[model samples]
Target: MSARRILQLGNPLLRAVSTPSSDSGECERILTDLRDTLHEFQRTRGFGRGISAVQIGEPKRLLYLEFRGRPYTLVNPEWDWRSEETFRLWDDCFSFPDLLVYVERSCAVRVRYQDLCGASHVLEAENDLSELLQHEMDHLDGILTIDRAIDRNSFCTREEWLRQGHPATRPEAFASKT
Candidate 1:
């Protein structure tokens, strides 16, 4: 029930794929730590929607998110479906809070996951929620936003991005997933 240190980029642990958690008690503890860490980040950094267990040096497939005033806990989540339509955005991560990476993600996605009680549930999301889930799920697979950069110029510091007038303009034609 305490905030844990977030692993930064270049940490080999961040590159290791997370494993599924088999113990409900362990999963619950990880979820609590994630929630605390996310809240701390929001309080100090001013912005953070979701966090994965791997970000806290725990290689477990767990994620905690707070979106639109609602909290979500996902364990062993897997994508059920992804829309062909995609959108580009300046994505940031708690692991690398000071950097913004331009990446593309599905406009809609359906994810299946287990809750704290070990019950399975499905979530259908679009727009912002869809993008957020995709981003966090990537962490479970050891994929960071930087790994999905659109190009060599797809990265910039948070300060530079703000200086550029927050150029998060949507692309006209949606790019196909590669």
Candidate 2:
């Protein structure tokens, strides 16, 4: 397994709906490549927590997550629950690392998925983890953060965001339109 090229923002394959993955032989290899590619991204770009198979040109329902020193391999992940309460944040993607999109997301979520070995498990995430999972899950369904932007003004370049001091987002910030 090696670090594969990440599909860029304009790649048509990024719009493909991923197919469910099996516990067959390719699971381990794909997961490995995902981890390698994630590490490579973090090393080069300095910020990346998770990646989906589709991001690496694999149209499979798989996700690799590493956050807070723990790693998770999610196969065929499905939403078990999503909180009604929402919050807003500026989200970025490895595929489009230079752009940030302001979007809203649920405050919490529970997901059902299988491990690399095919063991079924459920994960409940809150706050930051919730948003991160939602982002990656969107990738599985051929969605990107830009698609969730709050409005035409919700986009900012990484450079401009930094120039403006990388504004902090409260866990309760709604950025409501009403």
| Candidate number of the best lDDT | 1
Please list the residue runs of candidate 1 whose C-alpha ends up more than 4 Å from where it truly belongs after superposition: 170-178
lDDT of 2: 0.91
Runs in model 2 lying further than 4 Å from the true structure: 170-178
lDDT of 2 by residue, 1-178 (tens): 8999999999999999999978557778898999999999999989999999999999999999998999988999999999999988999999999999989999999999998778899999999899999999999999999999987778889998888789855223334432
Candidate 1: global Cα-lDDT? 0.92
Backbone steric clashes in candidate 2, count: 0
TM per candidate: 0.94, 0.94
Write one digit per residue (lDDT tens) for candidate 1, span 1-178.
8999999999999998999997999999999999999999999999999999999999999999999999999999999999999988999998888898888899999999999788999999999999999999999999999999997667789898788687785233532332
Reference-based lDDT, residue 97, model 1: 87
Residue 112, model 1: lDDT of 99
